[model samples]
Target chain A: MKLIYRHLGAIKIVALLAFMVFVCLPLVQMTLLAFVATLPHEELEVGQATLQNFSGILTDPNLRAAFGNSIAYVLINICITIPVALPAAYAFSRMSFVGDKSLFLAFIAFRITPPVVLTLPVFQLFSALGIVNSVFGIALAHCLFNLPISIWILQGFISAIPREMDETAFIDGYSRPRFIWSILIPQIRAGIAVAAFFCFMFSWVEVVFARILTTTNGKPISMAINALFGFQTDIGLVMAVTLASMAPGAVLLFAMRNHLSRGFRIGQV
Target chain B: MKTKDNSGWIFVLPAMAVLGLIGLIPLVTVVNYSFFEIFILSSRFWVGLEWYGELVGSARFWQSFARSSLFSMIILLIQIPLGIALALCIPRGRIWIGLSLVVVALPLLVPWNMIPTLWLSLLNPETGLLGRLGVVLGWPLDWKDSAVHTWVVIVMMDVWHWTSLVVILCYSALTTIPAAYYQAAAIDGATPWDVFRFIQLPRLQNVLLMAVLLRFMDSFMIYTEAFPINAGGPAEATLFLAVDLGEEIKAFNYGPSAARSVLYFLIIVTVAWLFTKAQGKLEEKAAP
Candidate 1:
């Protein structure tokens, strides 16, 4: 019986090790392939590693511009999302409004709507305004997708926070705005951070609408990465762009590693 | 819960305004466009039900709808249970939790474009590890040329990317299960399975429903990763509704695309509504 139990423990360990290795395989390959002199065009290889691909992409002006645009767009999205969502979340969490439940669900319903559904109308709308390919145009479009998610997650977080906090602040002579800014904001700092990270990440990585809306100057990194998907593949450039695109999200997650994971766990549930 | 301040309205205005201007306006536009015959974005003629009739009658549109719905169903059927199991395995406490989380989250942080690219290379039949191994072992795996293979690749990629979402959600719900619940169960001589079945599972219902709905909606609208992988190829085997809609929009077939989009939205909204209703029903059943 003891021998059987020991064998079972060994099996579990082996399974865990195998699953870990399997999950990490793509990351390992991507890192190794990025610096490789020549990636296997049709298929990946255990190749000779070098820094040429990364250098090539970084040095290109257009690529740099797109990278910059991605950062700017994400920053704009965060700014727009935080102010808009924080209040809406406060309303949903604190007050009972007419049509509150259904309205909240409606917002989520819109969030769940596929971007493709609105693509042409948005194109026409932007084109009519002569901002079809502009940064602000793309940023507005991003808010359409990201704001509801931000509000939903923030509402969840705010609901989890006790209502007594709000009443306590009110009783202590805090004005509404002051109370929200000074009292409520501090309490939900973690939620705000989580919302901000998600808004940034979604805006940073979105491709479909980004592709349709932005032509040149406002082209984000996902669009830039799309440029790498060619029939005649330049694996080197593709690897370079892929790595460059993922780097920010990767770095941010690494920096706020614990918090980010906690956010995902909380935000999702 | 005061209705008088209207200050709460001020808070909601920006988000509502943005959503209204961009999200809501376009939707209204799409509905309006679906009733017209549009050409070159310049001229349009009112043609009520014409585009809808054309879309509904088109075998291609129906085929793609079927394909997308099936794929989403399959993903949910597989991912939810698998995610719950993975979440169950993860122990509570800060020790080693950080490292484990990093492991789970690494794949999720990879760019959307990168996911398909990673899978494409990983499953490469020549020098790609899965491909090379399959050839050597005789699995005949070729995603680029086979619909079955493409679906498998897409499913695998999705599972890899999103099971983390479910796992993390379930984990959060699991951890919040107070020690007293388990202790009380154990004191009553409940088995591990009994504890999970009676206490843990019920607590997880809301989150699980959310996970399922989120996955359903996301997978139904899947495009970015799937598009780059095969471009909906292999004789349109992997061609889902989004891909079909994308092609239509790309070709500037605005009327038909709008009609199709409406149908797609209706289907998704219906499913989501059904889910919420079901959740409400479950809660009512649990009420004393």
Candidate 2:
């Protein structure tokens, strides 16, 4: 047993090293690309690093607006998804209605439905509504996907809370809205964080709907990166945009690190 | 027991309404379009089931399905075990565990399309580290033109991108296992394999199933990372289902695309249903 433990220690170190190298090497390279002025083979001295790539992205109105658009939609998506999911999640956790199971299953079904599959119809529908090329259109489309998962995750958290709290609040003359706002939400802060994290990650990274809906206007950072490859390729500039896109996620992950693993556990059950 | 009341409708109605406005409309429109040969929504001819019939016979459609299945299968085979092993290897010591988790999770935070961009730069033959290493080993990377290479690169990219989710799931599940379980196993002088079988595996089973559910669904429809790298190319080698659907939509093949999408949605829902059923079975089997 002692020998096995020793071997396991060595294995853990080796695995950790291998894992870091595998995961970080590419990111490190990409970061380096972002900082450098020119690719090595592209008529520039090796190690001639500069901050031009970052500045280049900010100065370009199109890329800057795209960065803004991506943030706007992601924020809009979380705003819509969480509020809509919360009440339904509360209902799911506390109350049972007719066809509740089937309706929930339908949500799971819709949640798994491929975004690509809905491209044509969603495009037609959105265009008819005159929301094509609009950030709000992207945000609304994202809600269709994000709301289900948001509900699923939030329901699990809400379920874990004892129903006795609700009774106590009511008995104490707490209004329903007051109870939810002051009691229910604070208790499920972690779950809300997790749900919002997912909604943010998915909506921020979502390319298909963002691509289809924002063809002529309101390109997100992803489209801006796409356009950066036209004619002459600026490798450094593209990597800068990619790195910028990851910032919100990185920030959120740091803030939610403690809640996330615990949140996933609740989600599984 | 939970409350059973009709008033639940009041709480759920908002979500249902929102979904109906956004979700049901497109869905109904898809079904509507599937029944017609649509051109620009204005020019249309009723062609009930024709597009579905065409899809049934289309070799390209079947090929994309096969590619997607294969890609998904490869992803599952790699990510699940790798994630589990990594999770187990995470030191139980508090500091080490936190550091391992955060480092492992870093890749997952990278946006989807950027994954390929990151990989492409890192695999650049002249400027990249791994590319240069490959040259030193006489196995220079060639994802640009070789179908086999493209498949390998994209599979590797997906694994790198998503394995963290599995790791996080498994790690969290591991943490839920009480410390006394290990102490008892040690008292019994249990081998590592025995301990894993009797304790860890049971706990891992659910999360692993979930990892499969998420990974399979996502990989089966992979497009964002893949399209940028090779655009489902080197002669359609990497053309997974979503990428194929993307091509059709880009071409404005509305009727066919709608029919194709309906079928695609059905496949995902069926797979998800199957997994959920299996999860139920597992729960039942475990229950006394």
Candidate 3:
């Protein structure tokens, strides 16, 4: 018991320091390089750094369109996923059906299925549906990946609440929908935020569907970066775009800062 | 704790329908494709499991599969412990907690495909800041030249990108431990290991299952960063199954790729099923 009691705090500090160095090095390097490389069409100087690449997000038509497309798809995916997942999670926790358990478990199975497997089939289906090459198509395509996990997380949070919350709400003459909205939703705000955060993150970072579905038009920022790498190999512009891609997620993580910490307070298993 | 109601299906109905269109139907299509020799969608001729048969017998398929399995195994072994350790080390002090969480979650926001681009810049020996630093430290990586070095960088990149998830989850599990429990441990003069083994580890079990499953499935299906990293270079030493599948898809080998997808998907689904079953057991144990 006394073996390491004296050095525990020091150990934690050392670990945190090591983690910070390891986690931040590549990112820091990227930030440094983003300044050094010149933007597209800019004549390279021997040692002069450039801020022109960061401004490319606003100035470049493809990048601007890609950013807009990426944001719209992410918002659409969350809107579709959260509303769908919430009700399913609510039912899984509060109500019992014949195959409810199996159905819930089935969601996880689909979630684990890789996006690569779904590419050709998704492209084929969307082309037939005529939603191909649109942000909406990419949004819907991401649902297959994000919905299951969102439901899983929401169900865990929902189940953690006491059953009495439901019983009392019902006895007080609230309808099932009303109870879920006013009382239940607020109570699980953190879960919803966590789920939404995940959905946003997944849709934002996903390249397979973004690449496959948006071949002709409506490319997301990831594809835009891919284009830059393929065509110009501009390190500065790529890092700038990559950093730009992270902006929404950073804002979201800050928004989720409190809720996320509290989100899993009930345990998400 | 719950009521028996068939109307619950009403709630599940929307997700079911959406997923049916997006998930189920595509899956069915893939399964259908696996049995055919596709020359464009319309020109596919029925081959009756020929692609799967070939995949099973082919040495190339098996070797890539074996290589991918080995990579997943190594990362899982490294990342799980590393994640748990980092999570434990995350101080709950008021000032640092929020910033730490935001920093930890930063990598998850980066597009998965660009991880390679980011790493490539960092590993460019002449130009990259990190690459230059490595040289200055007198330990330079032959990242593009050696298969072993490429593997190490890949592993390191994954650890950097993913360990935060485990830390966040473990933090949650730790948060669930009440102050009373800590006070009790303090009185008992329990060692750090004892607290971890008894109080913390028990709380972590549920989430660790989640973490392990997520890590396993992701590491198994890793494609985006890996494909772009070295493009399966250094004599094809890093041709993971997913990367190999990517090559097949890019080459327009539709039938074989679809078959490979089917085989690949089944492996994941089977593991997820087992995970679900195990989770059910854990829930049963935890119910009381």
Candidate 4:
């Protein structure tokens, strides 16, 4: 029994180490490549690493515009998603109304629908509306998916708060909106953080809709990176830009690690 | 807790309106356009089920569909069990738990486009770490020429990209299982397999179902990551349904693309619905 227990411990450690290596190796390789001055195919002198790749990409006018547009659209997406989804999620969690069940399921259906299914139609619609290639338009297009997911996650959080709290607040002469703002919103702060993180992450990373919905006027970083692929450019510069784009999400993850893990338990996202 | 007052509709109206305008309307438009032969932005004539017929009859469509299904299946088989195993190995202590989760989740945060770019760099024969390792192992690592190599790269990339989602979900679920259950198992002298089968697996059913559904849906619609790497290359051996649909859209083949899009939507919804129904039945059986 003692020998068996010792072997099990050894196996667990080995497994964990192997898993860590698998997860980290690719990322570490890419990061190292980003810092190198010369391509690995060219002379990979040990001390030739430089910040030139990062500086060069950051200063490029087109790349800067892409970065700005991506950040603008992602923020807009989160802004639109939160206000709209909060009320809807509250309604779904706290009240029952006609067509509630079916409507909620419709949102799930929308969530599962491939963005490709809606891309052409959305493009045509946006073009007709004269909002194509604008930040707001791309954000609105993203809301088609993000709004539903935000509601889904927010509803889960809202539902977990006891119903009696609402009744008690009502008895204390609080108006519906006031109670929701002052009492309920404070309680689900972690949910909002997680939902916002998810919205930001999804919008920031999404390419298909962003690709189709915007032209040069509002080109996102993903599209810019893709365009770079067309040109025979430096792989190190592309990797550097890619690493730079990952910063916002990495920071968000570290800051909200506790809320996210907790939120996943309650929400099912 | 049911309210007779239907005033909640007012609260939901704004969201519903937005969803209607963006989601429902576009969906309806796609359904409508599936019947039309679009020649230009303004020049379209009603074809009425002709495109659907063509889609159904096309060998290419079926091939892409099968390829998509196979890719999803392969990833599901690998990622699900692998994710569960990784989640199980995560230390239950506080600092290790947080550290492991953050590290595991890092790949998920990388933009989809970058994943392919990153992998491409990492697999370049001359300089890439994987390519160097491949050379040392004396293996043929030509992703551009070999279907098998492309498939392997795609699968490995996907597993690297998404298994973290399953791990996070399962880890969260595992944490919620009370200590008392494990204590009870220990008192009963349960073997590790018996304990897992009786306690952990049973507790994990809901999360596992969720993980399976999300993985299936996302992997089935995989586009951005795989598209950049090879764009379904090596003689189109990796061309998935999304990539196929994307090609039609890129080439401005609106009619057939719309028809194919609707069909793709139905397949996903049907599979998801069926999975949910099956899970419901299993839950009923287990509890009763």
User: What TM-score would every model get versus the actual structure?
Assistant: 0.91, 0.93, 0.95, 0.93
lDDT string, candidate 4, B219-283, tens digits = 99898888767878878898888988888899888898999889999999999889878988988
Give the alpha-carbon lDDT of every model: 0.77, 0.83, 0.83, 0.83
Tell me how far the alpha carbon of residue B88 in candidate 4 is from the true structure, in angstroms, after superposition: 2.3
Candidate 4 TM-score versus the reference: 0.93
lDDT of 3 by residue, A171-263 (tens): 999999999999999998889989999899878999888988988899999998888865446677788888878888999898777666555
Off by more than 4 A, model 2: A1-6, A39-47, B93-95, B141-145, B180-189
Q: Model 1 in CAPRI terms: which quality? A: acceptable
**Per-residue lDDT of candidate 2, residues B1-288 (tens digit):** 678877888888889988887788888888888889877778999999999999989998899899999999999999999998888888766666767777788887676767888887778888887887777887546657889888888988888889988898888778778889999999999888888888998987766776788788889998888887887789988888887677888898888888988898888888888988998898798885
Task: Provide DockQ values for all models, in the order shown.
Answer: 0.49, 0.60, 0.71, 0.60
Model 2 chain B worst lDDT run, 10 consecutive residues? B135-144
- In terms of docking quality, model 2 is medium
> Across residues A95-115, which tens digit of lDDT does each residue of candidate 4 receive?
888888788877877887889
Q: Which stretches of candidate 4 lie over 4 Å from their true place?
A: A1-10, A39-47, A267-269, B1-5
True contacts kept of each: 0.50, 0.64, 0.74, 0.65
Error of 3 at A236 (Å): 0.9
